[model samples]
Target: MASRCIVLLVAVLLSSLLVVSSSASSSPCTFPAIFNFGDSNSDTGGMAAAFATVSEPNGETFFGEPAGRYCDGRLVIDFIAQTVGLPFLSAYLDSVGTNFSHGANFATAGSTIRRQNTTFFQTGYSPFSLDAQSWQFAQFKSRSQLAYKKGVSYKDQLPPEEYFSQALYTFDIGQNDLTSGYVSNMTTEEVKQTIPDILNKFTDVIKSVYGLGGRYFWIHNTGPFGCLPYVLDRYPLRAPEVDSVGCGAPFNEVAQLFNAELNETVAQLREAFPRAVFTYVDVYTVKYSLISHAEKNGKTHQC
Candidate 1:
């Protein structure tokens, strides 16, 4: 549950925004500041320990130890940052001052859009929820402005004004609401009904950043939840016919439907703000590619 995800988006070369096949890759994204929003796939340290439970094996492999990321190696966000020559950022909760120099990761593990509210309970630390993350962005903007007034330079020496001007955002989420093992009681229809509200929450989150001057973003359509280990644990020996990729039918159908509605919603957002770039990454296809061909990623193919 702690493997929260995050994504990094930058000025998409509109010409290159088209989704490509596995043979080729996307062009280098150009962006200044990066803000991530999502569940375990992109969360850096937020899943590591912002809450009371243990943050285990979240950032292993490439980092060698916990850097708070949920996956084994650098996620897409890290790859994009590296592509643009930026240092790996720190989670917002890290007291380390260097995290402020580049970008800050606001993703929280086991969190959702409009799900958790920021609060302090004596039992454990409550990480920033989507609403809380937006508010924190406001504070970040103010502090950055102050830094500008004093002439403190960013890591690349870009002015705070330019920092945000070149900023980009990414979001890879929405699976947790339906797939968390604890929520097995929820029917597929119940999950589908929640899509509209999820999109609404996402709109609110995006607008909050827009208010803070974010003009470019990449939102991922939901992934095939039926392929995850937890899902397979529930329904092994699944029909390969229901899933061309052998994941499953029920979960993929929900993800596909959610992605369809999300695309329409993104089109609406694009229409409203023509100047802003809103791109949707194909989490569905990407995961399919990875799962169907795990050898490409050097992992054991499994249920």
Candidate 2:
């Protein structure tokens, strides 16, 4: 899942954020910093900072220690930073050894676009919803500037005032909103009914960030979570409900519907904010294709 997501996001981001011109120029765009807001997909260490340290095996393959990421190595956001010649973003919630000179990440594992009613202990969802993240960014912006003025020692730890406008604001979220509906025992149709409100909340955050001098936006539509083991194991599906790739078809269908509406939402946002550059990347298709082509390991057994 991690590798496939990396491939899709990196490919799309490279074309949109890295490509210089149509005439084969290799120069990447000069994005001074990256202000990211999303879930575990792009979370560097927000979850660990807010809750507890992410233990071994999570970052052993990359940093040789738990680096706050849920994956074994780098995330799509990490690649985005490297591609743009910026350092990995520090989590806003982490106070240990952080550098916000480049940018700060507001994402957390188990985060949802819309605020969840349940607690983290109850539903495994982060309370730092998209709205909360936007608020954090706002606070970070104001506080960092004040801190940056203190002395020369603070200059390298905080971003320049202009970096907020020059930075790339990336988003990869909303999948948990769909699953949260399911986890709460809502029907597929009922879950589908909530997408508009969820996206409205998403739009509100984007608008909020834009109002705060963010000009560039990179949004990723949710992927096919039905194909994941968590869903398949937790929610039993009949043989007829399963697709050729063994994913829950009903859930994938809902995801598709959500993506379709999300695409329209981005278009509407583009129209609503003319000056803000919005690049919506479709990760659902890439994820589903990769799942379909994936092979089973030797340990597989049929029920």
Candidate 3:
């Protein structure tokens, strides 16, 4: 899994450059910035700002201080940024003394793609829904324009074409949306029926960003929820529900269904936006591989 991760990061870096270089001739292929949206999978700080409980041990492994990231070390986004020679992105909610020149993270730990009123379940309300995250990005754009107009420092300005248009826009969401529904006692069929609406909302968010001059997108499908420690602990699988490797069959089947729809949606987006670069990353497969070969990957436990 470590080797696979390294290869994946390298591919991300190269593919980003390929997309940029293919679009323009005079400019270099390096990504000037990266704007990411999602939940805890790639959240850098939005969770910390929204909740006080996410502190200390959360970031102690690498940062030595609470950095708002859900992982002990760096996430896939961090690796992508480093591979592309960009600085680690800051969460938009952590605006104090943070830099947005390299872009910002709009993900929160418990954020969902569906807005509060639109969600299928009565889940906890969070202000960082996909709709709200798009609004925050709009605000960031407005502030950048205001700074440029006021002749503020160069670092404060967000050049439309040079930055937002050329930067890599990434999304890694929808896990919580399905999980929340399942935990709320919604049947699998009920959850499956909501997928089109969920993808519709997700499409709207992508179009909104595209309207804001985004031309490159890296969308990550949801991972295997059945293999998650929390899910495994909470939902004890029956003999038929468990796979040969011990992962929950029903949960993973739901995940694969979602990924299939997501893939089809990406294909449609490619057709809709012919000039744009849309890469659908199979995060589920990679994560599932880690779970299947845990000892080889040095992953002794699930988390």
Clashes of 2: 0
Clashing pairs in 2: none
| Better model by lDDT: candidate 1 vs candidate 3 | 3
Steric clashes per prediction: 13, 0, 0
Model 1, range 165-204, lDDT digits (tens) per residue? 5677777677765554225456778878888887888788
TM-score winner between 1 and 2, please give it.
2
TM-score of each: 0.78, 0.90, 0.87
Residues 1-303, model 2: lDDT tens digits: 111243433454445543442125354477889999989988899999998788877876668888998876778788778877888999999998998889999999989988888899888899999999999999999888887777667678888999999888999998899998999999999999999999999989988999999998888888888887888989999999998889899999999999999999999998999987788787787666656765632221110
lDDT of 1 at 35: 75
Task: Tell me the tens digit of each residue's lDDT in model 3 across 222-286.
Answer: 88887666677777877988897788888888889999999999999999999898988887886
Candidate 2 vs candidate 3: which has greater lDDT? 2
Write down the RMSD of all candidates, one decimal each.
5.6, 4.0, 4.4
Extract clashing residue pairs from model 3.
none
